[model samples]
Target: MRRNTRRRPTGARRRTFAAVALILGGGGLVAANTYASAGEGDSGGRVQDQSGGDQAATISCPDVGQQLTDVPGEARADVDKALANLDQQITEAYDRLTSTRQEQAQDGNFVRNSILGPLSEKRTEVIGQIKIDVKRAGGTAPEALDGLAACTEISPAQAQKNDGGGDGDNQDGDADTANPGTGQDDGGQGGEQQDGNGNGAAGPFAADFVDITKVQPNVKAKPRRTGDASTGTFSVQCGVNENKVFNTDNLIVAPGVDNGAHHTHDYVGNQGVDAFASNGDLANAKTSCSEQGDKSSYYWPVLRLQDGTKEFDAEQQGGGLEGNVGKILQAKEAEITYIGSPAGKVVAMPKFLRIITGDAKAFTNGTANANANWSCTGFEDKVQLADKYPICPQGSSVVRSFAFQSCWDGQNIDSANHRAHVAFADAEGNCGNGFKAIPQLTMRLVYDVPAPVIENGQVKNPYAVDGFPEQLHKPITDHDDFINVMDEDLMDEVVECVNAGRQCGAGAGEQPQEPQQPEEPKQPEEPQEPQEPQQPEEPQEPKQPEQPQEPKQPEQPQEPKEPKDKPAPQAPQEPQDEPELAPEASSADADKDRAKKPGEAPDAPSEASSAPSDAATRTQEAGAPDDARGGETKARTTSPAETSDTGVEAQSEETQPQPQAGTGSLASTGADLWPAAAGGVLVLGGLVLLIHNRRRNMTTN
Candidate 1:
């Protein structure tokens, strides 16, 4: 009754109630959409989404260097410096982005207006300078380069998509198709804890690692060997930067700029290598290699453990100040091996030829040139991860292997972009477009550090490779550099050993025997025919006369002794058998002697004796004409005996035969003789039967 008197259902009151319900429903829908967008763009455990719907995690710009394929040689220095400056600008911008997170949280437009705007302006000016430098040097600048100046912010999900989604598939189509760990963060520790470093930008988050044991085997089978394939490998024994040679300078990328890499590098080989080093300085520098002739410089990004330890470069631009903090981990083993091509025999690498394997900016620039190969020692054959770092088992060490481009352009030691001069072989191991195959430099770096613990999406004592601050110390950005400063003689040896299909290096002592084996077969073949008849006659003359005369003088009437002496003919056959076993025994003894005396130069003499003895035994087994060829066979057999006694004297004599048998065609003939000798034995047996039958027929007549 009271309501009926107070309000008679006015049209205004009804309209207000419906409007309020509509506003409340619309606000709930908007909140749901915002939360959905944040969840959709989450980058596993790398970063947390901001309240802004379209938040960005990093910056991505077009690679200007990839576009300038034909920069003039004269403009290279200025262009290189300018390019480095562009990198420096991006690093600075990234530094600012990390330092101003609170400002970004307060104002969503702060990153775009204050950070990205100034970065674009600076990049535009540097791009203009690059174009001018090229034009002044009589080279046409790419007009589209101006479009590459503007950069854009990208979400973490977008960054991962650009990098092949961390699926471990490289440009070669080889993939580590393992179910990587659960790449989800529980959102337990947000903000600074997300990156391990207090900086919000620099990171090697929990999502970046996968347990190696769980990874499925993904190593692609090597291309089958063709007739022209260079199958040998040459290893250089440069100690694993034991001298603590560390720097942030990249001589190959930025010759005159200090701290150009913006991350520390571990250096081995040429001791004088630095940003300021000239070609002459490199040539004169002392080396860390066991071979003094190998003065080549080899370097790669240093691995660091994020355990709150400050290093010598803690306050330096490329170290702690740039967010690459912590204790540097020296490689337990840094093995540098140069392998031959699967397509054809590799040519000698040009002196001072610069090679850079893997892209250092792969995180932001995309994975077009990414060649990172990460694994554990025991799991290398099972899985080679390109994007994620491997979590090794307790005893297994972390391994990073880089297989460099095997194809060279033949003309330039380096290109403007530092990549045009070299290229990777195809999946079939063929170099296309007239590219010549060169030694494929493969570097294997092993670290013996404790495994980092990842619990509830939080990583404890994480380890990462040094990289540009914007790259976030990603494993995909792992790279290596090399400059061939090897002396001409040493390089020739490497080429000869590789092309000849013989593994030769400081670590391979047995390789000397391979070359000698080919020569041994040829030497015995040439000297066998002429020396055989004379050698047998010389020894038989003394033995036959002395024995027969002694028996004849005792009994002249013993003419029947001639028949009895028939057994004596078999005595020569026994000596032939002894010669076969004697050389082998001598060679074995020589090897033992060399093994026992470790101080002696074992490679030269041991190979020399073993090779000739093997050749002599095979020749005797082939059944050279009896006592007629005995003297020559005896001479060959005695050589091993003499070598076993005095190694130095034997080496002097053995050296001459090697040069004479250098021709491969001649060496091949030695293997071919086995079939020829078998045929000869069949024919000789038939003749013996015919002669015996004829003699019996004549006696019957």
Candidate 2:
């Protein structure tokens, strides 16, 4: 049986990658290579790859940014350091794909590309296929998705051009590099990059991280249940080298830190949680990072995983998490944390979206308007909690904004919407010893993988993509209770017939059962109807036997549902991590924050919410982007610069008037947008349906 092939990166993304190559590299045989490791002749600070290992050579790019001149030690280390961090990510991803294609698993042994390997051998193949486009002039920069929203349309000419190029070939059309205001090839733009005398400017996307999505499998693994801890033997194995496991003898032999040990601050080696955020200021060991409450609001934390690879804070979106557990975009070493029922596998969310929840102001728009009821301190009904931060008994308000506000989960903070909280840090620098804020956050490319189906003593996903892995992503951090709840609300209705006799779209509502109840046992009206009892319509083909019914008794005799009898159950609330205390950011800060975007909204409309669906209304108010009815959610609009051709829009409650175009049909949240999914497409007021039957087969990354 044939299998589905992987969705290759579009020429746009590849070409963009190539352009990244051009801006970062120069004076080389290859003009645009995919990866950015410096070559043998590279002299500027990029680390040269001299190992001559199986690793493929990365295309080098010179550091090209407004304030940057020389490559930061960290960026160079990302390419040259221990284990070829970036290459390992790419190659390992492909190795898993090959295994899935070859059907090579046997019994209990699973041969996935381990931590030390590259993502794929196909690196050159995939990267080489990128397309390059040079806009002569008068071309505007196409918009990009915010941390998670999306949109996708092209100019009439580009659409025609794209259609012509759609014959299964992928190309990257990247423009060449020049100064922001000046157009020159004098190699001047390349040197403008930061001197690395200090950390460089954050890239539009995270820097130097690997994407594990290409190897994702469509089928989920049946969660396995191994023996519980009882046997006095507990084995903890992850993508770590044997050296990582603590050995009593080895411990005695090697008690000191090895300068040669894998981890180095400069390398973007780990992409787990926010490891860099936890680092001690280079000044000294005693003066390590002030508690989480002390670090600079703008410091770019490095996320490290249990396996040891890392991701720069800037690259969190696509890099997966930095730790082993709960990290969607993994950064480093980690032991499997919590797997849902059935064990070894999990159902991951489709997107890793970021959204704006609220600021300390009351929005003028309707309640459904993106900024209505925020938990911001000065916003209506919000209490001041900044003073209580750092659990300080005194001067509580003096705490770092995130600590007081609880930006991680909005409840602790003052956000109104749940989807977006705070720009990682927007509060005051009133606190001591903090760095500048960093915000050019963007999501990484990712895909799903199912457990391999077991066939003839082998187990694997039956539907693995031909060139991708059957399973990818370590495991999701959240149980997605919201998804569970939403699914519950729509489960019965999705399969039912609508009043129009059309199949319900997903779970819209339960069909009217009162009229369908079995006919009340009619008192046999004897001969009155005998005249019609004659031929019974000439032996009509037997209508199939009455279908089965639920265990509940007939509805007419049953009681009415009391949907709104009591105050409704509140939606789950997240804790806030920052307080609203600081001065607003500078224009420079605003420029850096405009990069991330949310993903697509559903391709349908929600109906107006009625009293009966008040519970869902409350859900929407709690932070869900959609209303309960699916079609009746609020509408949000964005500037053209804030949206992308892929239909994603990046917006924020805190930032003012960033670029946005067209209304936000963005159901922009997370891979597991459970609450919104249950309600379907809930625009604030009005929405557009972007879906058509024809594109159902088109793939989304």
Candidate 3:
């Protein structure tokens, strides 16, 4: 009943499930932090590794993937171009889904919306299959698509773009867009803001600010496949604003177990999700913590960083990302413009937000830090049982004792110059053990996309340009918007079924002839008075009576003319809450109702069987013995036999009334509309693939 309320999700839900990705201050950690990114590569492939230290020996697990973190990105886009194309397509789809509303308001994301109808679920499955298709093509298994892959190596130009320097309205501060492929500014890169590139990093700024239009993912297919596979351009965005993620799953280790150099080896790729560990490994931390399906921060250190830069020591506890950050305070020169960073992963999956407190130094905190692990998430914080922001995430921890070691290093240590602030804990509660920690800010940290598509078999990459937040928002909008249209199409089918039942079946007409009234029981002529015994006496006197017999008023009063004027009015019937007649019933009439059932046309020749099906049946039945055909004859129309119920077959074209063909103009317009999304998918993929591969030798440097 709600007017067109049912619709496909536009990935606006990602905003709702919004987890801020904060690219925090960079630095190194001690013993405990070093062990997080440990994966060893081996031929058997089941090979896994760990930080080669006492820490590695302490933590024990059966399988390697189990030891890895399940980050957000399952939807795969291996090369930079692939990532860009996917980003463009997703954003475009969203624009169609929520052209009229915004994410924070009405729209939901792919995962949530897909649950609404059949196609939604199917959409999710198709994407998963695509990942398999690409993997089967001999590509390296991708890092999880959802969130696991962290950014690394931003181009100088890309870094400047983050500073908010650009020309255009994006620099003016308007993030929301009704136009396809854009979104309203949410205070980050989505609004009017200076472009965050080159010298533009910090000019007038807008969160919705991004300029991906230069890439133009809104494309079409060519009449024929060009050898290079180039079809159309795909607009691309550079930052979080432009990335409208969807059904992100966990890109996994089906990739077989790996065993490779560890401890002192430079990681080949984003070591964040390696499936193997070195011979020695640090135990993944486990606390009584739970979040959006993730439990235990067992692989915390590795899952958080995508730089292929592994630097943590799981052995000493208070010395990993958090701890090293504390140390950076003392070791690094101060920047008046602190460019304070936020915790991006924590910001994205609200479920991961949590609160924790421990001593500022490995020496002071290690004693109690082992058990001091604490956590809380966005929702828990919202209702306020805890004291953190609803936007933060939750996680477990590994302290000094995790490696089965007890460093009673004399308590008076601030070697890291760390001081904790109540803000560091979670969306819930917080405690300051003296570590000056600022939630990191969200920013673009890397650029590498998927491979370009092949035309008639050659390669062409399309997503050549990158955009900022303002630029990114529109794409997300477009992505969702298109999906919404798809949702509408699905609903139209439901209405079609309902109409068929009402228009072509028995329900379309009056109930079969009201039961014919039972014939009034014939009454014995008012019982002839028993011939009185007088008849006996009369026999003897017959001779004398000859004269008067005719005159005797027939003793029986002439049966008074039966009264023709009165018959009890049929008792007024009670009101029945009648169902409204169907739209087609207006044509039904008594003449039609009397026809014989479809296919029951008597053995008579066509000319003689002139009566309609209903008429023939009713008339023929009426011709039966009078005792059986006592009801009054009446004409009524019956509905045509519907194939589902009566064996009646579909009528030939000649017998069917023609539906007005859609106008030529309307038909043409619809035809074009149908190809937009499909064509866009392929075009964007080809273009993005080429551009992404341009950067990779695909050979390890």
Candidate 4:
């Protein structure tokens, strides 16, 4: 009736309504996604609080020592004590922060009021004392030092970024994909339960580990060696802390302070090393090294399996009480090698020189000074991870390697920050800022333990390196300490050998001679055989009886000639055909001997030196730095010389390696923004269609 004259609801009107609905729906999705992205970006890379609020994951303070470059020698002791107190204050505050999580969840200001406020106050007092110490010692403390007293809280995400995402967890909630379960039983100490946040007494979140096989090869090529390069290598047979030489003290960092490291360290070289040990004590102490000449103290954080086993330090301050718990794992192999500079001749390390490589607080301090190198035995050639603990494949042992700084300032044996006195060489292997090249200490530690398991975002039978309470046992906090205690004669010999480009050390002499001994007889025989014929003719002319004696003399030489020709030629041929064949053969034989007698010396010098060539080849082929892991050759934010405000020369930026891109952060960003961007496009398209339909409807009307 009315429809006969009135216009019915047109298809254009229906299309207009559909387009409007599409625009509304797409706009809502884009807005929601934008809000979510903003929220995540604001999280500041911190571990999300399980109680549904954002809280600090760890405490961070300015490194006061890094700024005290010119503390007078007299003030160092007082300043050191004050600095150690600062660390203690932070440790106490961290304990409070972790223990009062419920309080933090209840009150937003709890961390600031109950934890950080008190910590800042304590640090301020300590900083004031440090200033007074320097002033009293006729040195000036920077007024800017006062500003360093205040500390702030950092999120795990921020820390991970600073560490270049070494912990293997992406901020985009992709940890489940990064770490997959192997269906293996939790094999170490059993019965340890993780809290809801994936932390326990000593933590290593499931995100802290990665399937090593999944990591891309990041080892760079070795620095090119020049004519002045020190190509020789000096290795020492340091038993793998077999005698249980473990301590939680850092002699170089916090002398005279107990529990200085707040974690256990496996010490191998010096027998009497502790926070209070004087240089004299180290020099006179017995050593774990096969050569008593190498009394240098070598120590690093001990690795432990979280299997519910109580260790000697379990109840001690630097152990379980400080959050370093679990069954300590002894390294199956500990290789300590001192290689010469690749740029110039290496001088002997100054006796009593203190060197601390890798920051012990790297998890909190950031990776500017972090020098951790982790990989598996079979995969070390392919990849090395700086931040993540590798879940090594079956039959592969976990490897932790450290390459100490090799460039030494001509003046200081030790600097206030410890790092200012030494620096790593450039990518081209040249030392900068007039720093002389010194023997580079490279350490390789292998642990034979069941691979840690992760399932449903939980880690089982987790293994972690010992570290500060706030550090959460992250692998990036792994570090090593060294104090040169080598006797003058031994040090001189090391320098001579390195300069001469000869392999010399605990096992160098024993193994190389065996390979060359089979070749030695061939040389003497060539000259002796010609002399033998002439001698026989002369003897025969002198007397017929003498002829018999001359024949006997020739026979003696001939006897060795027969056997030497037979096996000597064959032995030399085997070595020539495959240089590594002799060493592998010798290693196999040594392994048998070792298997037969378990109580015998764990590492024989011959066995240790047998594969020196092969090891050297691997070191070069893997593109590892001559001084440390090749992957650690990142650009330094602070120059070693610039760490001192005094007349120390500044290191040239051109000499430092450029920071590589992919090495900085591993979190995926572009892929995450795709869905949001796509929705935005859809919303725009819907708006365009709605406008077109509305215009058509208007025309029809």
In candidate 2 the C-alpha lDDT for residue 302 amounts to: 17
For model 1, give the 10-residue run with minimal summed lDDT.
632-641
Give TM-scores for every candidate, taking all chains together and pairing residue i with residue i. Answer: 0.64, 0.17, 0.15, 0.64
TM-score winner between candidates 1 and 2: 1
Candidate 3 local distance difference test against the native: 0.18
Please, what's the RMSD in Å of model 4? 19.2
Local distance difference test, candidate 2: 0.17
Cα lDDT tens digits, model 2, 366-461, are 011111111111110111111000111111111011111111232221111222222222211111122111111110111111112222111111
Against the correct fold, how does model 2 do in TM-score? 0.17
lDDT value, residue 492 of candidate 4: 90
The best-first sequence of candidates by lDDT reads 4, 1, 3, 2
What is the RMSD, in Å, between candidate 1 and the native fold over all Cα? 33.3
Clashing pairs in 1: 532-629, 533-628, 535-631, 535-632, 536-630, 536-631
Question: CA shift at 686, candidate 3, in angstroms?
Answer: 55
Any runs in candidate 2 off by more than 4 Å, and if so which? 1-202, 205-619, 622-638, 641-701
Using lDDT, give the best candidate's number: 4
Off by over 4 Å in 3: 1-123, 126-701
Residue-wise C-alpha lDDT for candidate 4, range 1-701, written one tens digit per residue: 54577778778877777777777877887888788775453221222333444566668777787777788999898888888899889899888876775576567778888888988998899899898899999999988899988878754334333242223222112232122112112222111123322335336765566676665555444555554556555777666654445567777878987777777787777756667677776766666666768888888888877766555565677877887766666664577877666566888788988888777776656556666777776666456666678887665667787778888897888988777888877666677778888878877776666677665344677888888887777677778888888998988988877665556775453111111112223322234333333432321121121112222222221221222232421122111112221132133322122121111112222321222221332222122322252212331111011122221111112112111111111233444566677777777888889889878777977
